[model samples]
Target: MTRRTLMAAGSMGLALVAAPRALARRADSHRERVEDLIARMTLQEKAGQLTLFNDPFRWRPGNVNPGDFDTDQEKTAQQIRDGHVGALFNGIGAEQARYAQRLALEESRLGIPMLFAADIIHGLRTTFPVPLGEAASWDLDLAERTARAAAAEGGASGIHQTYAPMVDVARDQRWGRVVEGAGEDVLLNKLFAAARTRGFQGDDLADPLSLLATPKHFAAYGAAEAGLDYNTTDMSEQTLRGVHLPPFQSAFEAGALCTMSAFNDLNGVPTSGNHWLLTEVLRDEWGFTGFVVSDYTSERELIAHGFAEDDRDAARIALTAGVDMSMQSGIYLAHIPDLVESGDVAMEVLDRAVRRVLMTKAALGLFDNPYRGADPEVERRVVGSPAHRDLAREAGRKSVVLLKNENKLLPLPKAGKRIALIGPFGADRSNVFGPWSIFADREMGVTFEEGFRAALTDASLLTVVKGSDVEAPLDGGIEAAVAAARDADVVVLAVGESHNMSAEAQSRVNIVLPAPQQALAEAVAAVGKPVVVLLKTGRALELSGAVKDAGAIMVTWFLGSEEGAAAADVIFGDHAPIGRLPISFSHYSGQQPYYYSRKATGRPELPEESEYKARFRETSNTALYPFGHGLGYAPVSYGEIVLGSETLPWDGELTASVSVTNTGDRPVDEVVQLYVRDRVASLTQPERLLKAFQRVTLAPGETVEAAFTLTRQDLLFIGRDMAPTVEPGWFDLWLAPNAQGGPHTQFRLVR
Candidate 1:
């Protein structure tokens, strides 16, 4: 169905209004329960439900570090008793959550339940690969399974809601938060968003194993200027609707219970106070019934953003804009009631926001049993279980993308060869889990040395050397690394940014290996040993210097707890590297906003033509590694692309098929990607846009046909008039492994 149609249909169970009275009554009771609670609440109590704050007692057990603990805990406790706080975030354990929930249930006048939330972005205790790494796998089922495991662990920990599945379609690597989202493609982001939402919420929110899924940074937070986090965003409405908003729509359609508003301002309007985005687009147009929460201090930041006069104005604007909850801002708590009483903020608006928050609590069975998922026994049995760890290992393994395999240098022999693992990440344990892994036990992750030794025939065959500290020069580090490389039969150089280098507020202007590490890589490569580069990073980097010329290059994004084991599995040929790049790797840091689906420029720089037109003086126009690019043990070749018909009716289906053959000695899973382009349009179109993709596993010498069906709606675009339209025109289609050149064909759409 079209977005409009889907929006009009609303969420699941809303249709029960027309069903049998018994079923309808059950659905009606949810709303009735929320209404009844609101009736008993004072204006202050109602405002409290729209406010959320961090847990005061979230510090590690027995450690109780002074500065880490909330100093205003006494005041906060009184507020909870007075029904002035709706939710608590960063509640570490079930016991802690239960303690806070008890304050509201037993001590408060209304006995309302308080919601607990946390940033379970990738995983909870048993960390999985970062979101970008998982996206590289291009395996939707695996992504869903990982999300499910995260939800299970989170639910057991008394986390009623998880701020996760950041579905922002990020194209720039310099954006630090890119690690939290799926990469550049809209379709890929949409599919992963939907799958993750389903995994987090499951079939029912009332289930004890389920946690409320929140697809966050509601709109266009990923397209920050110069790839800086929380930077200003300026784009046409067409681009916003076509590119940035689809994933959010997909997540909502998949039954997401909440959305987190972005910190960035779009077109001079802070997202927290942008009524067009939070209300008109999210609620009225897209029919998202879920509550919208402001990003950390985002409502208060509206003053900093120059969009509001003060804290009171910020609260009023955000409330009117449809932001139901103010995260850690205290704007809603401090000023919401006065605004409501003074008639600056309407009572209906406050009630609407309060109702939405209460409905979510009811859906989670928090009203019936606030501690439904907060069981100590369940926490002990499920959190970081052996089964979850195994899944993490598999997820990490699949996320590793073989970027360059020169002369088949990978799948190193398990015996005979002396392997030297050199670089900062060689034996690093803490950095493997990456960022936003708040609850993960760093000690649980296997070190590279441990994993490699386990995979080797003899433990003595491997020697590990910490070549240098990340971004820091270590005295004599390069010399020690070079000596180790010279003594070994081959060298595995583990290098890339540390976890902190690519998360919130960590944007880098130079997205290349640090100078010290670049120097270290060159020194080791000079030893003449076959060097394999295992790049452990959260975001795409400009691979240059000696590292780019290594015999093999693998992009192993922070593969969470099983990083070491997963890397060893792929290196030792226990598993084939099948991941494809979801984002393009630029050759130069100057290519900050580079992507494969760029619009056709007026002065196009065709590879086959002269370099005088739209050409860069220092670098080529192409990406270092294009989107969907990767290699496996076996080589897969694409056959001729065949279309069922040369012409398709406006409302009819067009089937496109291609035969893929595994031409090597081993089995391989290949991602068959399909791209389409409009030959002519009122508004110029992208050179090619990703339309369809599927992963197929084929045995040696096996050929399989993969087909994709496209309806006229698939070609729809936001036209110059700012409405979706599919003009009758000629179109070009290509089937390939990546965004690079491939076999092409042409077709037409006719009315």
Candidate 2:
């Protein structure tokens, strides 16, 4: 049939079968037709369609082509024509995506559609707070709903995919990817993952606003050695499936259609080529029918990990192991055909992956209208809309953790305080926008200067001093800044890494604040002024000196463009800073991956010679501030816990409840946490494990109750068989401010 004839026929079918979908099918036969098309494709062709891609942003800086493509435009053209290169990433935006996709539909022999995807992590055009910041909000429902807006805006931008809901558990503050994930609690991660996935993907994949939300890095990429991105992941298989996979499982049950492999290896097997992880566990065990994509260049990196001999071997191992998309490994594009012909890889493997990919695209209506993503609708509604911005702002506020508020030093009277805003982050719009913030507008970022102006009026008379640069030295401005601090009532010392300082491949041997800035803050603090230290960093930086010296410390884990105003509102007492720390603030780098929920060592060191404890010469086992620690202007006190039952069996349930009251004068919010200690187990357990937590707000002198229903699932650990199951034992349940329970109460469950 001629192209015009096919177009007319397709449009006719579209009118009758245009799936404005809910519970009804436009036609069950459409899926079958897609299946038939998949059946007709060759192994190489199918694998090609399953090849995943990122947008142009992953390209090294100033690489004119966006990504590090060497004659890649032409390669893309050939791949599309060959019915290969199924997914696209890292383009300039929607229009660029549309133009690039034409190479697939018009020139490709099969006329199969290409999927356009982007890293719509926080917001599209209107940036939201980073995921870590959003986690601080303790508003899972809101965060998720905001994600819905993100999907709508992203979808409106002609994008059908988002690499989001990065639910990796960041136990180590040094891991750069921590900025992309929810914090260290299993329950929190589950809730955040569900909300974010539902928001990004929407209720139905067929909805244009609903991009295929992919939960990624398959396993823990957050617990990298020294908290570096794409570093080695070493964990027992039992621990892997227990703490890490729960969030992913939650995402899957919520309808995540895609999974991305990690750049790291699990137990010496690279995730991109680990069948035990990709197929047996994620797919076969969990029933994740979605196509799995390798992380950028991961399949090829198999050589680096010593898992594969070369690119050709990597392709064979990856496909055989169950990767649907190569994701720029070039392994598939380079050696898949040879492998298939050599009988090293099966054609059926490629075909199966292709079937899944094409099925999703067909569901997305890519075949009926290949350019469906790049419509004027997306441009009109998605980029920089108020709704999107509001979502981002809310996410940012939620993520901001109030680390200190002793003496009620916060909620500074917005009307009367002579606030002196110092430090580099105070006026930087760039630092607030973390890595993977593609669609967020950089220029519109709210700096601390803007935040102060918005929070405090002309009556407050806010003064500015560039005390110390968060990115670089002040060029000898410290003396002048200290002078400014002495004259002001409050000095807001804004500091942290530069915007580009803590992202991917930006690992550091040291996590201290820059020497110049640290010295500057010390000088300013010596002036005897009350200072609020606002940190704008991607990864956690050492804060022992600052914590010991500053009147207040706030872990602003890189709030986005709207941060200035939101932070101002919280700091100056307009809004109480109720947010809690998502990750711990270690006193020293020796703590490396220090977190509350960590496995205890077999030898469990004693404080022999006083040097055997988990302490460094420079700092203590104690973090500058502990995990789950945060401050509010008004004080909150917890009442005695009332357990529904003191003891329970493995199959039985335990109910833990407590009453919390806002004891101090203004209204305040408190996060009541539940932690447990397994008296004994087959393997070791964390010194303390966070079980349940709830964020509650009460007016001054007002009291409220918080409760949690605990089941066998809540007590589960990865068994020797690698199945998630609970052990038979007595458990100590502790309800307190941090993971460490204030007093021990016994609960028993026998398997």
lDDT of 2 by residue, 405-494 (tens): 667677677676687788876666767677777556678788878877876667347778786666456666887787778779888888
Please report, in order, the local distance difference test score of every candidate based on alpha carbons: 0.86, 0.72
lDDT of 1 by residue, 567-673 (tens): 99999999999999999998898888888998878888877885667868887778889999999999889989999999978878788889999999999998888
| Maximum-lDDT candidate | 1
lDDT of 1 at 421: 96
User: In candidate 1, residue 629 scores what lDDT?
Assistant: 96
TM-score of 1: 0.95
- What lDDT, from 0 to 1, does candidate 2 have? 0.72
lDDT of 1: 0.86
User: Model 1 Cα displacement at 621 (Å)?
Assistant: 1.8
* Candidate 1 ranges beyond 4 A from true positions: 1-27, 58-71
